[model samples]
Target: MNRARALWERVPAPVVDIVLVTVAAMDLWPMLWDDTRLGVALAALGCAALAFRRRFPLGVFLLTLPVALTQPFAIAPLVALFTLAARSRNRPLLAVCVALAAVTSSVPWPLASFSEVGRAMTLIDFVYSLATAVAPVLCGQLLQAHRDLARRLAEVEEAREHERMLHAQAVLARERAQLAREMHDVVSHQVSLIAVQAGAMQVATKDPNAKEAARTIRSLSVTTLDELRTMVTLLRASGGHATELTPQPTLADLHKLVESSGTQAQLSGELPPTVGTPAQRALYRTVQEALTNVRKHAPGATGCVELWQDGDHVGVTVTNSPPTRPSLALPGSQHGLVGLRERADILHGTLEAGPTTEGGYQVRLRIPLSTD
Candidate 1:
């Protein structure tokens, strides 16, 4: 049934109109052979007029009425009436047209013969013609109702899909909120103790090497606490409100970050103040990750962080010299560079990290200055 309907819709409008005109002409052909020139002309006009019934349904129905008057049970007028009924919403107007068609079909042509016909016989014919006229109007109204129902069903389905998406988002938000609470309450408290203990150890130590180790542990723990706080804020913000998040790091905080990194590092060069917030964050994260790596894997090494702008792009490059002393083994997930590369990709940028020719490591990130 669906395939049939699809095929029917694929047929051109003009082709359907032509088919209707042919069927109407066939219906009136026999009556035209026995009629006067005026009757023949009226029949031909009514048949041809069906081709335009879809556009001018009322006018076409009026034209087909003459053909119906010349003969009983005409097809042209019924098709015209159906077209008008489907397109028009005026019920009184449709009822009047139906009545006019029934009367025209029942009345004997050439009005002089009406007196010869019996009243009872005329009434029977009129009743039968009225019943015939009603069929097409009912069919047209049913089609109109079907179209309206289909449109309403489509709208309901669309609304259901939207509701499903909103429900999924709400579930995800709840999960994120719970995770944020865990990080703040449990993880943050533990990291605070590690930083406090390291600070106490640094103060109590006598050997220079032990003192340096304690200071480095304290610095790393403090940095981790700050990052944990930031993460908690981010998770809570994701759960409901953007206003929950603390102010993120930008170029303004670069000096403080380097000063507290527990490494020998130099900050140089300058980007335009017009650089966007996201690019600034990416740049800062790149330098932070680089200095942390130097402190862990390149003990006693010094690093340089340079910021520059080239044409439409702004970038930061961090380079560190080879270790002056043998490095200690450190636990790491090794996802820092991967995360940085992902962040660069989100901003339509790139990150490159590799060893320089001078037995040192270089990490560079370039992103659009207008990145949001």
Candidate 2:
């Protein structure tokens, strides 16, 4: 069946119409003996009009009116009525055309009924003829209705799919903006500290050459800070609400963070006085992010925050034991560790944050330092 349809599709439409016309003409051939010239003329004209029925359904329907008079219950008239009913959207006009086609057929051509059945047609014959006339038009309307419904469904589905795609794109754009803000936070904090440290160094240096170099360093650091600030502003401005210009968390907040942790969180070891503000803030964030993760991923877990300094680096670690009970699943964007990693990179430091063999999560941050 599919192969036949495919072949029909491959055939030219005009060729298909010509074939239908020939078949219809053949069906009306038996009646051609009586009307002779009239019968043959009507048959040829009505059958040929079927060729353009799809393009001009109403016109072809009107053209086949004479064929209905000659052979009322014929193939040619029925095909024309079907074409009009299927193609025309004007319902009243279609109904009028179909009514005319059926009514004209009730009267025989050359003023006589079919003698083979009876001299005068019976009521049953007339009813059957009317039924046959109506059936094809009804079938055509039903098929056309199905086609229209399918087309409407397809359009609705395409619209829904387009909206879904746009929503997905918006989500991706928002996530990109958020990631940029996280990176900006880390860079700004580190750059701000650099500017401050450079200004202090310029003041402390006594030697002329050292002081000149320190001044240059201070100027460059200030410029870097300005650029970072601009970038951070742009990234955060993507959202509808304005970004809050909050102060970064530092060593001063370390005690508060530990106190706030519901777990048995303790801050141990002394922080070096020489540790820069950037390093302090980085350490504070490392501990803060780790503790937050613990609360989220391992509720009821105990944690310890350790801050210390070695000869060349300032170090901090936040460790949480496994949950006392079962872990509680929590909703998180999981951007904390990514931000911590960015901070460490900005300070030319290394951070280790992962699960321990003891069924705990550990975070370690180390920022490099040098003595002038």
Per-prediction TM-score to the true structure, in the order listed: 0.72, 0.53
Q: Write the per-residue lDDT of candidate 1 for residues 1-372, one digit (tens) a residue.
A: 989988999999999999999988898787677789998899899999999998899999999999989887689999999999898889999999989989998887787888888678778888999999999999888877888889999999999999998999888878889998999899889888988998999899898988987887888788788889888777777655645666889999899888778888999999999989998999999999999898888989999999999999999999999889998888898999999999999999999999999888999999998897
Q: Look at candidate 1 and tell me the lDDT of residue 30.
A: 76
Encode model 2's per-residue lDDT on 106-177: one tens digit a residue.
655555534554635744555666777778789889868977998999999999999998898688668768
Model 2 residue 157 distance off true place after TM-score fit, in angstroms = 1.2
TM-score top scorer: 1
Off by over 4 Å in 2: 1-12, 30-34, 112-122, 199-372
Clashes (backbone N, CA, C under 3 Å), per candidate, total: 0, 0
Q: So what's the TM-score on candidate 1? A: 0.72
Q: Report the error of model 1 at residue 313, Å.
A: 2.7
Candidate 2 overall Cα lDDT vs. reference? 0.77
> 269 in model 1: Cα distance from truth in Å?
2.1
